[model samples]
Target: MKKLPHYQAGVAVVTALLLTTLAITIVASLFWQQQVQVRSIENQRLQLQKKWVLRGALDWARLILREDGRGSNVDHLKEAWATPLAETRLDEYVENGRADTEASDATLSGQITDAQSRFNINNLSTDGVINPKEVIAFERLLTNIKLDPSLAAATATAVANSQTKKTTAPSGPSIVTSAASASSVADTSTATVTNTTDASKSASNTGQASTDAIPEVQFLRFTQIDDVLSVPGFTSDMLLKLRDFVTVLPHATPINVNTASAEVLSARIAALSLSDAAAIIASRDRAEFFGLTDFKQRFPDKLTDVSANDLSFATNYFIVAGKIKLGRSTLNFSALIERIKIDTKIIWIREL
Candidate 1:
């Protein structure tokens, strides 16, 4: 009886331990769930706040662009809008519990860039046909970036194909059958009918068998810079090198003489060399190009054939790129802003 009581006590102790362990596990799990929910809510709040900040940044950018356009017809690096915002702490902008203690370390920085600084890929082709001059320019650009120059033709062909493709609705059944295919031609159920000859039936069958059917093709349009990857020769790495100097805009635009890089300048003007482009850039820094005449005077020998159609002194498209560092995370974004007659509009914006 004494041994039995001790054995029962031992079992009771084990049971109690098991129950305690289960209870602890349940409690811990519930606590963990609550913690996760709290964190999720915090994340949502942060995201909402970030969106508000982005909107404010966009509005500020628009104002700057509009004001800049209103102030002058000529845009240059010296302009206020052209200046980059350094990483400035947003502590003053944020509200914390106390004036001295900071809850989040937030910083904002951005820059306005001329999209025309790069070569627009849309210029490569026009209405399903390649432009020889633009092709040569793109070829030079590829060579300058140490990529195969042959890729330019493939790129142009892709762009042209995209433009040529028609988004036709589901058309009615085509007349795939030849004139001799039917055995009898009748106006209606009660109308007079003429019988088709055996020779005609044989001709129809022969015609179908002799000629192969041509399949219809749907080409992909270029909407963004990465669409170049659809071309046969473009690689992701090649794109990284080319991205700095090339862009795919909505429409064709002339290269901006005031903002184009040395490589772009030389490529744009076939007669101009890289060294010549470098010299022009050196002088351009000293003086803003008020017109094509100012640009022409820089390299008279090389720019004799160059006209207003090929180059512009000002750009309507501007890219606003910015970074926001908040707490442990950093958000980088770029937006395309278009300035037309003192009015600024955002074409597109993306987060990176």
Candidate 2:
């Protein structure tokens, strides 16, 4: 009987400990769930707030671009839109003394860049045909940047093939006819030496079997800088180096003399010396170019190879980049805007 009482006490002690542990576990689990719910709510709120802030910045850009269209028909670095916002407090832009309502911790900084200032990759082809002149210009640009000039033809041909490729329905249970095949070329000139045939025919001339089919990804056209990833040999390093000098636009655009870099100016004008390009950049600082005639008279020597069609003093496309931070969330965006005679429209926006 004494042993029975001791054993009963031990059982009671064990049962109490198990109950205590179960209670603690339930409380801890409930607390963790509450914490997670609070955090999720905070994140959602911050994301929504960040989205609105970025949208406001985009609207502000549209207003500035629209004002430029109403006032000046030309685009130059001297203009207000070309000047960058130098990390100003977000509240500074809020009008009507709304600083108390806006978040003070956030900052605003961005710039409107001239899209036409860079070489357009789309210029590689015109009306579904390879353009010899554009290929030469791109080669010169590559050479100026210390990249292999041979990459110009291959990149252009790939982009051209993507544009002209036709898609068909699947013909079999396992596989079907694809729109086009894109493969590596051993020689740069094999695909574009004559520039007379279709992109597929050019691929065939490389001595690869005509019946050989390789998978290819096609785009209606290049829309962003990263779109060049689809082109063979355009590695990340190459794109990083080229992004500063090239852009993709919906339509062909002439180079803006007042905004183009020295390298671009040198490449676009045949036989133009780098020193001459520097001189032009310096001359623009003294006075803004209002017309091609003004640009011509300033650099008469360099004008021999360039025509009026290849040059411009104005830009139709501009990129607006904006970033905003709220709490632990941040949002960044790049928008391409087109302005024509007081009418401004956002063509596309890419979230970064």
Candidate 3:
């Protein structure tokens, strides 16, 4: 090679350094891009897994309904159902090679109910007032269940407030207070008056002092459950606790002792503990309770407050909650069901 000038040699070195830098930059960029692509793929896979798990939950719910002979009435949105599971069991269900036998153990739950029974608090306003009887009965129901007294008071106030019309400005201050003011004062003075009045009226009408009398009043329906949050002592935790077993329906249908879970039955009858109620359910699952008489026969002393005439084995309403978990993903699903005697026909089916 011919001898190069000093400036030419410097230019050659600079060009080589730039080429090396460019090559390194390109390699680094490719590596980063590959990592981003991998993360994106993983995210997509996780989403797919979650979707599949939800589908699995639906399938599990369907199976439970079908087995219970209540599959035909799975359309109602207020029915009650539940299944709890461990995380390890959920992982096994998501895996392909695992036996389907343990699939039931994968956290799944479901419920069904008639929508009409519950009072939708959202519907009530300063204009539309709830029935006084309904308010009293609801409060009594809460009290019977040993819910926080403050919550019950708050619920009554919310309902009353919802229906109360805004008072017109007084034409002039006078000795006689306005009707609205008087009513407000009265409500504050006698919070329990409504319950007492209802009990007396019920006793008068039926000629029997019965604990079941309160249930006869039209109940708050599905949408109304949300209104409970407005009640004074009702916390998010309280609402969650009550959500599983209760329903607001257009009709005041009695809860079926046969199908009602221990949590619910215990709420209805004070003497029944959750454990004792569960034992009763387990026993009845093997054989249907013939009647309240039979129930009394089983636990004569245990069921002191509840009578045979007050109980029913036939259930018209149910709730089912379904949860499915696959891999790291999970889905929660709920449905209300009504038991109707009719020819079987499918109505609506959602995959996820």
- Best of the two (2, 3) by lDDT: 2
- lDDT, candidates in the order shown: 0.82, 0.80, 0.54
Q: Which residue pairs in candidate 1 have backbone atoms (N, alpha carbon, C) closer than 3 angstroms, thus clashing?
A: none
| Residue 336 in candidate 3, Cα distance off native in Å | 4.4
The alpha-carbon deviation from the true structure for residue 280 of candidate 2, after best TM-score superposition, in angstroms, is 0.8
Taking the candidates one at a time, how many backbone clashes does each contain?
0, 0, 58
Worst 10 residues of 2 by lDDT: 179-188
Best candidate (score: lDDT): 1
Worst 10 residues of 3 by lDDT: 73-82
Q: Candidate 2: lDDT over CA atoms?
A: 0.80
* Sort by TM-score, top down from the best: 1, 2, 3
Ordered list by lDDT, greatest first: 1, 2, 3
Tell me, by TM-score, which candidate is best.
1
